[model samples]
Target: MDRPRRIAGEVWVAVGVLAMAGWTLTEPAHPAGFITWAAAILVALGTAAQAVTGSLRWWGGRLCGGVVGLELVGAVGDRFGAFGRPGSPAVSWGDWSHFQAEAAQLVPWDRLVVPAAVAATVAEVVLGVLLVVGPWQRWTGKATAGLFVIYLLAMIPGMGSASILEYGLPVLIGGALVSSARGDRRATHQSPAVGRENTLAADYK
Candidate 1:
């Protein structure tokens, strides 16, 4: 992406982080929700930092990915009654069952909710670590792109317009990262070809 667009995307991501924080703070009783939002904020801030400073882009990408992985873990934990407190209605088997039904309606299959959720959550954590700490970043970017697609599709049926409004840009941002990473790989591959052509020209001269 061009510099201006990159900066704009970063700003949007930062704004989303702040918005999620503001929304979460209004419900102080929901600690699990707060934690998830905090992770999302970290991701947004990290990605924004990438746009702000080119030298730290790798760090920023890793930070965002790491936090996103945490968010996924928190989501999985929340599903299993891990976030419940004594007087709070945080854990509800009934609600979870209902959610399963909803998810089934959106994307129906055998063992849809548990299996899909578990798989996606695990993948998110793994991909996040790879993005942050591993050398295979282009693959990481592709994995992230696929994960975002799944998330967007899964949420849209239930969340409707609100989900789209909140998440659409993130999906776009993911796509941008995938495209840019792929472009970098292509450029790297072409370097040797360019070098060979340069040597051939020098010989002719």
Candidate 2:
């Protein structure tokens, strides 16, 4: 955590989004919902500021680490009552089952999910490894950017504004790495090239 501020900001923003969702679900509570919503807004705003100012790259390692951490924590939570049972996840259990059933009805067994699921899962795991190991940040950055696009595609099929709000933000954030790449390139290109020392000639003589 080279930059503790960035990690705090990013984590806070994620939490803030959660808080906002919770607040909205229980709208117009006598008084306290307003406070929760306000706090959410502040956290997200702070994260955005840090992200845009180039002060949060320290969280690069944390970003990769977070991918695994969140998944581990989620898997563990679901094992208990924290996330409800297998057939029904606590939050959107009904919708989840409905979607699966609908997809099953429409898709044929032989022609269905195996290929895509395997390919995508493999890619995800490989990308996660690359991200964690810091093997090639450029390649990883580009891949992450592509994953962001894939997420947007996921949202598009749903045809919901809420989906866009919930998922598209990550795509925007992924663009941060792309932006960093371009900035690095520009800085490299602008620096004076090889041994061309053209100092002022003999003015003091």
Candidate 3:
């Protein structure tokens, strides 16, 4: 909630995401799993770089953009892999099988997964674009926070540990996003009270 604290939070979050993704990448799972892991790290790297370079100016926008772009790339991979032949490349980690199970049980899951993936991917792209250009920025941040929360919740009913972590990563990202967007830290940093003691001493002269 303060500038130093905000910086500290961002640093820890960046570290956590990189650490989680790095471990996953080394562990060797499905291609989908690897891609998701890879994407998380990639976004974290890009985000940290951008933050250091001052690309965001504000706190959250650039990081959100980084993840949105990363996930959009992931959406492409997921759509391609999900639509591929069932046995092709051995369909890593049973996601294909889970989709099959969901399809069989729900009848509409097949239809839903594809469409939901499409819509979410499209939304990510749109939000990314909005973030880059200024006017629509606030909406993009809110949308990302909302979607990340939903994804995290959705992971609960049956999403395995990996999937749960996958979703959790973004939820944390969104939390940072919300924190950055509100930017009470930045405001407090600039507030006179923050340095009023020093100012008061000078005034006595």
User: TM-score of each candidate?
Assistant: 0.55, 0.43, 0.50
lDDT of 2 at 188: 28
Best by lDDT: 1
Go through the candidates in order and give the clash count of each: 0, 0, 0
Candidate with more favorable, higher TM-score: 1 or 2: 1
User: How well does candidate 1 score on lDDT at residue 164?
Assistant: 36
Q: Which candidate number would show the highest TM-score if scored against the true structure?
A: 1
lDDT of 2 by residue, 72-128 (tens): 233233334355544662322233344344333333474664454345445655655
Number of clashes found in candidate 1:
0
lDDT of 1 by residue, 1-205 (tens): 2234345446546655555455446645432343444555565656665654333554565565555444444445554556663234533222345445545655667667677755765785676555544445545555666666666676767556344333333623443352223222222234656744543332112
lDDT of 1: 0.49
Question: Residue 181 of model 2: what lDDT?
Answer: 30
Alpha carbon lDDT of residue 62, candidate 1?
53
C-alpha RMSD between model 2 and the true structure = 11.8
lDDT of 3 by residue, 1-205 (tens): 2244335435645665755656557755632355555545545554454344232333443454555545544443443465355455433223444444532332335567656655655775675555444333334545655666565555655454455465435534543353333222233245556544432332112
* Ten-residue region with minimum lDDT total, candidate 2: 196-205
